[model samples]
Target: MKKTILITGAGTGIGKDAAFALALRGHRVLATTQTEAQSDVLRIEATNRNVVLEIFKLDITLEADREAIAAYPIDVLLNNAGMGESGSLAEVDMQRVRQIFEVNLFATLALTQVALRGMIAREKGTVLFVSSIAGRVPMPFLMPYSMSKFALSAAGAGLRAEMDQLKKNIQIALIEPGAIHTGFNQAMTNSKYQWMNASSYFAHQAEAMKKKERATFKFLEARSTQGIVNQIVKAAEASRPKLRYVSPWIQGFGIRLARIFGV
Candidate 1:
C-alpha cells in the first residue's frame, strides 16, 4: 500500500531523513525545500538511491509556495518545515517573535488548511505534524520556538476533534521528538541571537545559552533517528493512529510527566 507523500523542509534534519526513508519504503515522495540548493541535493540523493522522489521549492511562508503544493495530489502531508528563535522572553525582539510565528505557526497552519480541504474531499488522507517536545514542556530561553509548537499542538488537537465531529476518515498525527540526531540543535544555535551577544546585560546569559546548546547537541547526536522515523512511518500507515505520537522513550516519558506535573 504505497502512498503519495509530500514533506516540507525536506532538505535537512528529520525532514530529509523521513523523506528518504519513506521514499525507500516505496512511497511516491515529493520532498520540498526552501532553496534550490536543497532541492538539488535531495533530487540527486533520491536519484542515486533509485527512490521515487520529486523535489519542490517551497519556503512554506509564501502564498505562492502553498498554491504550488495544492497542485499535487498528495495522500499524506508532512508539515516539517519550521524555524527556531532563542532569547529571554522579555529580551526577545518583537519583530523576531512575529517572524517565528509567521513561519512556524502561520505558514504551517495555512498549508494545513490548504491540505485539509483536499483531504476532506478525498475523505482518506493523513497529515503528520512535526512538532517538538518544547510544545509539551516549557524549556528555558526558547520561548519563541516553544510558543509556536504550543500553537501547533493546539491546532492539531482541534483539527483532530473536528475530524471526529465530521466523521471523516482523515487522520492527524503529531511527531513530537525530543532531541534526535538532527542538525536541529545546531540550527537553533546558529539562528538569530546576536541581540543577546550584543547586550551587556545579557552577555552572561548568552554564554549560558551556548553551554546548554553544546550539551543538547552532544545528547542528540547520541540518539538514533530510526526510532522517530519508525514512529512517523507507522503513524502514516496505521489504521488507527493515536492523536499525538511522541518519539523516543525518554521524550515520551517526559511529556507524560509534563502532563502529570501540569506543565
Candidate 2:
C-alpha cells in the first residue's frame, strides 16, 4: 500500500537515502531537514533523481516546526534527526549532554506525541526511531549520544506495548544501525577532540585515542548504508513491524554476544 511517510533529518546519510528509496518505491515521502538550505538541496536532489518528494524545513527541536507535523496525515513517522557528542561524562559539559537529550530524546518525543494524537484518532500508524547499536552497549567517550539513544530505544519499546494494550493498531519500532560509513560515525568519534585540551583528563592519551577510533571505524564501519536502509524499508512497509530492526547483522550479533558475556 502507498503510505505517506514523514522523515526527519532527510538532508543526508541514512535518512536521505531512506527518503529517496521510499519515494522511489511509490510512497509519498515528506523529507524534512533541519535547515532551509538542506531542504532546498534535498528538493534539487529529488528532482535530479526524478523521484517526487515533499521537501521542507523542520528542525525537530523547534516547537513551530514540530507543530507542522499535525498538518499532514502521515502514515509513518521516522524520527531520524539526532545529534552526537563525545566526551567523558565526568568532565563533559552538562549543557552539551542536555542538548543531546533535547534533540535525540525530548524533541523526538515531542514530535512523536504530535503525530500520535492524529494516529490514535485515525486508529492506525507506525513510528520508527533511529537508535544505535551503541545504545545496546556502553561506549566510552560516546556516552552522551549513546545515552540518548538508550533512552529512545527504551521509549520505543514501551510505546509499542502501550499501543498494543490500547488496541489502536499503532506500530512502534527501533532501527539500530551499526557503524555505517555515513560520515556520521567519523564525526561522532572525532567530536570529543573538539573540547579536549592539554589540561583535560584524557589529554595524555588523546593521540592514542584518535588512532584507536580511526582504526576501529576503518575495521567496523560498513562502506555503505544499504544494509541499514534495507532494514528501514522493511520496518516501514511491514504490517506488523518487529520491536527492533538492526543492520549489518554481524555487528548486531557481536553486540548481542558481548552483552550476553558481560563484555
Candidate 3:
C-alpha cells in the first residue's frame, strides 16, 4: 500500500537519498530541508527521477516548522535531521553542547511529540528516529553528539513500550547507522579544530587530534550510504519491523558481537 511519508533533513546525506528512493517506490514523499538552497537542490534532483518529492523549509528548531508538519496527513515520520559537535567532556564549551542538543535531542523529541499525537488519533503510524552507532558504543571526542543519540535510543525504547500500553498501532523504530560519508565527520573535525585553535591551552592536543580525525575520515570514505537508507525505508514500511535497525553489516555485526562477548 502507498503511504505518505515525511522525512526531515532531506537536503543531504542519508535523508536526501531515502526521500528520493521512497518517492520512487510510489509513496507520496514530503522532504524537509533546513534551508531554501537545499530545498531547491532537492527539487531539481527529485524532478529528474519521476519521483514525486515535495520540498519544504523546516528548521526543526522552530515551532512554525512543527506546525507546518502538522498540516500534512503524514503516515511515517522519519526524524532524520541532526547536528554534530565534538569536544572533551571535561572542558567542552557549554554553549556548543547546548546547541547540539537543541538540534539533535530536544528538537527531535518536540517534533516527535507533534507526530505522535497525530499518529495516536489515527491509531496507526510509524516513527523512525535516525540515531547513530555512537549511541550504542562510546566513542572519543564527540561527547555532545554521542550523548544526544544515546538519549534518542532511550526515548525510542520508552516510546515503544508506551505505544504498546496505549494499544496504538503506531510503531516506534530506531536506525542506528554506523559511519557513513556524510559531511558530519568533516564538520566535526572543523569545529573541533577551530575551537582548539582559539584556546591557548589546547593547541598541541588539537594538532594531535586532527591527525587522528584525518585517519578516521580516510577510513570512513569507503562506507556506503545506501545501506543506511535501505534500513530506514524498511523501518518505515515493514509491517512487523524490528524495534531497532542497525546498518552496514560489518559495523552492526561487530557491535552486536561486542555486546555478546562483553568486549
What is the C-alpha lDDT profile of model 2 across 63-90, one tens digit per residue?
9999988999999999999888998998
* Every model's TM-score: 0.93, 0.99, 0.94
Per-residue alpha-carbon lDDT of candidate 3 for residues 149-181, written as tens digits (9 for 90 to 100): 888899988888888789888888899888788
RMSD of 3: 1.7
Query: CA lDDT of each candidate?
Result: 0.83, 0.94, 0.85
Quote the lDDT for 80 in model 2.
94
Q: How would you encode candidate 1's per-residue C-alpha lDDT over 98-158 as one tens digit per residue?
A: 9989998899989988887888888888888888888987776788889889888988888
Candidate 2 residue 112 Cα shift, in angstroms, is 0.2
Candidate 3, residue 193: lDDT: 58
